[model samples]
Target: MISLTPLKMLVLLFSCVLSGALGGYYAASFSPVPAQIAIVDVQALVKKAVEKNQAQTEDDAKALMTKVKSSTEELIQRGVVILDAQSVLTAPEEAYVNIE
Candidate 1:
């Protein structure tokens, strides 16, 4: 037969309360912060994203401009070759095929 005297009952009750309190404290400490209640700098995040996108867009535009210039130059050279093909063929043959 286990008889809990006044002193033992007090100690048992105190231990249970202490253990429960410690457990609650540990659980609270380990709990994740709710997303809706979390702190964040929305403006700073948006600004950073905008800056990154702007820089990427500028770099893309530069690459596109370089490509366009190169393509334009190639087209111009082709046009010149097409326009001068007849003159270029006659120019080299005049001296080589000349019969005296």
Candidate 2:
């Protein structure tokens, strides 16, 4: 059987206590700070989305709407022709994604 001398036991106990205290000290020293910075404040930006529409004017919006309506009518006119000669491939031919 092995034995621990009293002095050796005292040294071992002290070493264990010292190791725990240092580990706790290091953990506290390296812990993260609780704060962050936002690049943009959305509430303020939404309030500024239109100081008065410049590039995208009321007339421009109307023109785009008319273009969309015309394109939609053309698609409806040729709906069956498009429905035939179909395959899994559509737009983005390399990637196959299920619309549903």
Candidate 3:
């Protein structure tokens, strides 16, 4: 028959704790490597996006201004108006249509 003395139990516990800590250290040392990261120039990417947006906005604004100018010129060519039945009757057909 075997009996465990307090001293033997303490030694066993200490050995278990020491071996567990050592095993954990070794496991961490051989852990899987991290995935590769793709490098990007964030400043350049932002600048390009901003420039593209500005160019698109400018193009849209120019087209709108051109359309507005042509419409205004057409209105001017039609003739000036004072509140009268003749002005209403003679107004351009385009003036009556609902523009999108």
The candidate scoring highest on TM-score is 3
lDDT of 2: 0.47
In the range 12-51, model 2's lDDT, one tens digit per residue, is: 9999999999999999999985322112222232234444
Which stretch of 10 consecutive residues in model 2 shows the poorest summed lDDT? Answer: 35-44
TM-score of every model? 0.36, 0.32, 0.39
Q: How would you encode candidate 3's per-residue C-alpha lDDT over 1-100 as one tens digit per residue?
A: 7888999999999999999999999999999854222122333433555676765566665665455445445444655222322334354443332211
- In angstroms, the error of model 1 at 16 is 0.2
lDDT of each: 0.50, 0.47, 0.52
Runs in model 1 deviating more than 4 A are: 37-100
Clashes of each: 0, 0, 0
For residues 4-95, what per-residue lDDT tens digits would candidate 1 score against the true structure?
99999999999999999999999999998532211123334335556767655666656544544454454446442212222333333322
Q: TM-score of model 3 relative to the true fold?
A: 0.39
TM-score, predicted candidate 2 vs. hidden true structure: 0.32
